[model samples]
Target: MAEKTALISLNMGGPDRPESVAPFLRNLFSDRELIRLPGGAWLQRPFARLMARLRAPKARRAYEAIGGASPLRIWTECQTRAIGRLLGEEWRTAVIMRYWEPRAKEVLTHLRREGVKRAMVLSLYPHFTAATSGSSINDFCRHAVRFCPELDYRLIHDWFDWPPFLDALAHLVREALARFDGEQRHRVTLLFSAHALPEKLILEGDPYLDQVRTTMRGVLERLPEYRSRSRLAFQSRSGPVRWIGPSVTEALDTLVDEGVREVLVVPVSFVSDHVETLHEIDQGYRDYALRRGMTRFERVAAFNDDPGFIRAMASLVASRVPASWRDSRQNENGAPCQGTP
Candidate 1:
């Protein structure tokens, strides 16, 4: 049993509300942990400000397509509540979206005010990448030390290789495969799509690509039946820089060109259906696939509130927390940590 309790912090991604787009994106771009800039700080702010102004209108339109705002926060709240329920009243959990409401700084401030003695920084992202989890962890580290200097911190870098997470992903994929029609089942090709990172980052020794590959490997090892048909793809890349390729849309087109009529897209990167999954995959890519003359283009549902997923998350929290909180700290007596470390 632990002598002290630990609070878990989360980065739930960003929002898409019309009114909030500029501020939200500005926050995103301002994070030095993301969008690394070479110019002076003064120039960077103006550059970011300008980009936010230019991008907000177009961003607002996309958000408007799927109801006037992003549903990511709602999903985050659901996850927070579910985790809270599973952890019970002993361990308090608060979510902080890096570029949206309940921002990271605010959550840290709240935890500080609550007098938390220890904390666990958990990015909703299971895979580690400088662009995603690294950015959030860097921000938390920078601020939390000054904000709560006395607190002990345990950061969960990644859960990409955990067994429960792998199991949950496998279970979800299996369930989706079972639902496919007889003609679609054996003929279906699996497309594992993830958010893209610049080629520069991969060359710079960022483990994002490797970690994702491990995630793919774990999924494949658990699915002996699907191994022969699945392929990996990348998506949602921005800017002019070269990104990890065999882009999802390009892959979809190629599959169609090759006479493969049915394809199942698994958004293995994201835990929730955010703008990328909800709009990009469902609307943009689905439209592209339909236009390319593909007969079926079904997306595996995001992990959202799946019981297996929730249980996996609970298990992660349980394993990470001290025994004093849950009264079962012994290694053999308590559940072992099972997600991507």
Candidate 2:
């Protein structure tokens, strides 16, 4: 019998419904890997619960703005199916959301039932961070050891500057640019926005900022037309603690100072549509840009289920699959394996 193989995509999950918002926040805050409680590890849960209660109303409103729930799980399901098709019949693909229902425990249980012997875990986050990829991978490993110790696992930590991934982004940028007329195209500033993390993470030597910068460089290298007109900014910063510099808001202000009237926002950090993309970027930043006298402000859609992105993800997975278990099918029947050479 062919060896049973499983591919797992790790992500930071959001609430699927309005009611789940508070609980989701609670789960997110409770994770020590994300934010440490002021008191002690023992107080983490209580503090998280309290903070969740306080933040839920605002979070719910954000979710309400974007069709009552996050579109992340929906997009992730489509992505998994696309990748599964690419992987052919011998392999199975599963999504593990760190703070949501389809979590590591459930994923491991399902994989065990499927008789999976080898697993290739892929972090959906192109850039690695202790809060996101680190937390998810650590949670999965701890559970896998306790629940499915026999399972063999391989992890692709980060594919930040992967060629195919950059290709997909460049394609999206070109598509976004096409929306403007020729006269306006030259004036459109390509703002590459990534989620903001606390400055302390960079000070502590987290590779996320460096990887994000590299990813930006890679994507810009693929689009010479936008290199001089492009800028990188951080977004979705919360709380009182100082975060990264040149935030999306501040970046927009600078554009206003430079008399840039048109902007095309590209969310480089996120692959799927979520509150960050929908509410934050679309509603929040668009409004900010317009009120600041920008005539045109549009956001490039997330690479959710895009064929090139799916192909890139498939290639990433296939590269990690043992040669003995690699499926021989190709062309019309299977996805082409294309990645960074």
Candidate 3:
């Protein structure tokens, strides 16, 4: 019924305000695919409400520490706008958050109203996992069928080793490493961390770990000097359920044992800053490392709206979108970025 094409970006959105935190937690905990409760499916909602009620206070404090809210929605908006501009007026761009506002249903309905006939649904997750990307994609498709069955959408799931993506990561890593001078540059162990997943998911043949490892290898290949010190660790591990190992704390402990005082942590999995990087590693890990006798700690600034990251994503959009509908705009104003105003 429509003619133009669309590019839908998927991300795990965060609470923009203090009041939204409880609801975000509830939605996150209630997701059966992302988290499995002790009881069966029938109990998930009840458990979610209780858990969210209990956890909200600490979560709100965490948000408060990081400027009273998550910058994810703002950053996602900025990133999507940049991507949209790059693709031109011919292609409409929008973002869908997994556990927050502007979710799949809302975005799909908006796209339908905008008269988008075909779409390239891209996962912001570079690595594919059932818990993250899978859940987002499944949610999008389920709602797409119900809300806009006539619209055609093609999925662009993962690009863990995509050259441009890897390059963007390398650029940030190099930028972070430059902060150190002389021996500290090479002395700092590159502690790469990613949000953790339940151990059950990995044991059941999820390729998330494998894909993340691949991304690490790609990044190391680009920066061979850091390869010797670079190591992968997991962060943001929650729940009583068994999750991935060599957590940020454990990794810090090992680095301390090895007489490594300085660490340059790279969030290998996330493309932008969220609670994981801004709060967990920046605050929690940094404080722990300091108390544990480490001298210096640094994190690779997230590639939020860096021009290079935008170019890479633009290339991805161009490739995934049908050539017939693809239209590259010639902008007299090159590489403009917008922030939350």
The all-Cα superposition gives candidate 3 an RMSD in Å to the true structure of 6.2
Clashes of each: 10, 0, 0
Model 2 compared with the native: what TM-score? 0.93
Tell me each candidate's TM-score.
0.90, 0.93, 0.93
Where model 2 places Cα greater than 4 Å from the true spot, the runs are: 324-341
Task: Compose the digit string of candidate 3's lDDT tens values, residues 1-341.
Answer: 13687778889989999999999999999898888876788899988898899999999999999998899888888988899889777778889999998888888998888778887778888888888888888888888888988886778778888899999999999999889998898688999897788999999988899999999999999999888888889988755689988888998999899899999998988888888889898899999999999999999999999999999998987766554443443324211111100
Task: Score residue 225 of candidate 2 by CA lDDT.
Answer: 82
Per-residue alpha-carbon lDDT of candidate 2 for residues 163-187, written as tens digits (9 for 90 to 100): 9999999999889989999999988
Q: Which is the better candidate, 1 or 2, if ranked by lDDT?
A: 2
- lDDT, residue 110, model 3: 86
lDDT to native, each model: 0.77, 0.85, 0.85
Could you list the CA RMSD of all candidates, in the order they appear?
3.8, 4.9, 6.2
